[model samples]
Target: MTAWQSIPLIQAEFLAGRAEPRVVTPRGDLAADEQATIALFEQARGSVVFIATTERLFNPWTRNALQVPRGTGSGFVWDNLGHVVTNDHVIAGASGATVRLADGRAFNAVLVGTSPAHDLAVLRIGVGAGRPEPLPIGTSHDLRVGQKVFAIGNPFGLDWTLTTGIVSALNRELPTDTGAVIERLIQTDAAINPGNSGGPLLDSAGRLIGVNTAIYSPSGASAGIGFAVPVDTVNRVVPRLIAQGRYIRPSLGIRTEEQLNAALSARLGIQGVFVLEVEPGSAAERAGIRPARLGREAGFQTGDVIVSLGGRPVRRVADLLAALDRHAPGDAVSVTVLRDGATVDLNVTLDAGR
Candidate 1:
């Protein structure tokens, strides 16, 4: 059993009904943290959203009424614009859906867009009548493994369920049901069960930083391991969904060897990604992107070894790409090359990789 001693502010749902646990308080009374955590949860769960949907089932019963099925999930108010973000899986195949705010007023919802790769989606609700407090946004990039976080959602049809825990990991590229890798995810020990999908995983300040998306459990319940789509990814994708109804990312147009082996560290002489190829007419190739044609390859196709970019050391192809993310297309940058035991510097202009 993995001990959750590191995250004291929150407890897993599986552990929620268990024995009393000790916690530290400002007064040092040696009391259990459970009660105090519950109180904090109420305060942090700024707003709640109820998503109700109905589906048609294969039941040989009466007319349309018996053929209809229903389901519900949780969501939080995202902004004053009346946008709500949630897990795509939650609203998947919904014939009818609506958002019920904390104030008890309900509004119709329409799918803005969804990224199945990240298991996230944004929806637009008119809120034509009700007043809902939009959840605040926070930077997941600044979250630490042991920092406190709170999750507000409806789990297993339970409305407004709140769970707390500290971040268990960072930059976790966990795969979803479709096996698309979700990049830069925030892993937490917070108890996230069914219906919690798409709910807000907030900081102590009630700022939204992550969207509760998945849990690691063989028993279909909270397994103390949960994954959230980082808010940074949300901020980037949501606007595209709202504006153009699609997401577009210009690629760096380069390919390099993936660093699969940590032990190969000694043989590479340097710690970085190996440049393998620069696609023709790509931003990389046009900007003088070098490819690895030899060294590790066979015959006349020996490639150039790229050791650095813009004066920053690049150990792997991802490193170079990581450095490029800080820049946009048409930007000029300096690249350093390590060839035949000598270093060469070159300036190249980047092209849009769209």
Candidate 2:
């Protein structure tokens, strides 16, 4: 045979001997737990939203003001009434915000209310008939450590990302930029990052249990320790925000300054909030809670030092506020104070804040 004829014969033999594509093994059904997780994500993803905020910057040279992108975060459909919930910090300085739903529909969001103390904000959008169903609410008080949790958010601007973890701890305390401490926060081991703020943290049943707010990482990224504003707080605050355009925290009708309290507490060698003054005709005045007054000796005659409220120790102003947050305006609570070197327990009915 000639060289060309030999080459064809060799090529034919090689082609005939070559291996065929292996048959794809059937993957059968996914594991039951995996299927459940997938179902949870699919169902919950629609409720989550992407929030982009903008700030208006004034150009001195051109004498013009223009809105520019400020930041991006996450949020969730709160109700059929066009309410959306997110972190206060997410839209703190933004002049405007746009919320994008999972189905690629976008709407301009209007600020309804915000509670900086709770780190929660409510935004309203008119989504019409295509509004997503609100996430089913869950209680955080009964949540136990080690329970499964799934977080859905636009982390790093990557939309609709799902991260799974377990409730590493509960009742965690996180301080906010408003100089107040947010108590009863849920801590999880989920991979929460910068853009994860205002996202939903769901339980195994896909119920909204928390709102991812912050992470405890030195490098400003996920380090397995993420904190969420507990749903219990959210449920209490969001509705009021929607109704009143602000969260009116239950107040004791007593004035207390954080800085003054700290200075007085240290000077007196006592650890409690110092009562500055009681509002006239208020709950504190009605309960006979005394206020500090200037003594003839050029010193303060401390009238009442709040040591406890509702059985929670009040070492600082934040503690008093946190305790009051657990109750309503009309609820009765026990206020323990230091008066004339005696411990006095008084029953006081909370009043609506101004």
Tell me, what's the RMSD of every candidate? 12.3, 9.1
lDDT of each: 0.73, 0.91
Model 1 spans with C-alpha error above 4 angstroms: 1-46, 56-67, 253-287, 290-354
TM-score leader:
2
| Candidate 2: regions farther than 4 A off | 1-17, 251-354
Which consecutive 10 residues in model 1 have the weakest lDDT in total?
256-265
Query: Cα lDDT of model 1 overall?
Result: 0.73
Residue 282 local lDDT, model 1 = 76
State model 2's lDDT.
Answer: 0.91
TM-score of each: 0.65, 0.73
lDDT of 1 by residue, 1-354 (tens): 256466454655556768686786566454666556666566555567888877766545654444254677888777788888888888788766788877677888888887777677778888765557777678765567899888889899888888888999887777767767776788899999988988989887777889988888999999999999888777766766777665545355666434322223356565655556678887667656567554444653434566777778886644565566556567778878765667777777776543
